[model samples]
Target: MVNITKDTEKEELIAQFWPQISRAAAGYENRPALSDELAQEMALSVWRSLEGFNDQCSLSTYIYRVIHNTAIDHIRRHSKISEDELDEAMLCESPTPEKNTLQAQRQKQLIVAVNQLPLSLRQVMLLKLEDLNNIEMSEVLGISEANVGVRLHRAKEQLSKLLAGMN
Candidate 1:
């Protein structure tokens, strides 16, 4: 297994995976400020953990596992936030120049649904969204492949229900 030994390698990994990391962070937090804060925390965590990253899994899986774990911890620590504080913390997602209003609105609805999913389901769904196969997701999450499939199936069902309700 190749060991991570250089700052440049670390920088390259971060640059390459930043979009996935950003989306995962934003998808986890659902609030712009918190998402940015969460993403920064993820970057720092990934930077520190670089030396320990064994090449057993793909870099994508490893980085995602770190980000997901960090996001979970952040959520746990902030669990005591009040309803009003949560409302105050909420922010709309930023608009992408290429996406029109209808597209943006649909995307927003999807994001909201994703954020509302239980973490296990969300993790599997997010990883799947990034095009990881069942094996990679299972390895990254330390769950059985069967479990990943079950969770994904349930998550998709839930998401469909959620979108249906929104319509």
Candidate 2:
């Protein structure tokens, strides 16, 4: 059927997109271990949706959209736990002193705080921290430059509050 041919073509396109997808994903360190899985999912989504792409945007832009959305989806799905629960779980685990338990606790707090942010604000923060410039971020998030600024501002404020409470 036509679907089979299209699926095969999509698989080939995913192969082409893999390297850049992984590179783009590298800058997200909050959950570094999920990078490979997230990148592959993004690449496959872009490939499957390629036929419907209107060419209104650059291929890079389209790919970025796919990756950004996938990352946001991952974050939202994993953000359900309360900070208290996270802290309790971490405390229960026994880590070596060389592992710097305090530093690990702080990092966990940071991630939990980020998770508490609204999805739009969280996405902006993550993309910005990943070092994507305004234009690149706009392309990736499918948002206006001005909106990205607003979201980043709100996200920073929320993160500061969360961090302050964590100490």
Candidate with the greatest TM-score versus the true structure: 1
**Model 2: residue 45 alpha-carbon error in angstroms:** 2.1
Backbone clashes, candidate 1: 0
TM-score of each prediction: 0.87, 0.60
Worst 10 residues of 1 by lDDT: 86-95
**lDDT, candidates in the order shown:** 0.83, 0.69
lDDT of 1 by residue, 60-154 (tens): 78888888889889888765344455455544434467455688778877877887788889899888888989998998889999999999999
Model 1 residue 41 lDDT score: 93
Give the Cα RMSD of candidate 1.
2.6
The local lDDT score (0 to 100) that residue 95 gets in candidate 1 is 43
RMSD of 2: 6.1
Which pairs of residues collide in model 1? none
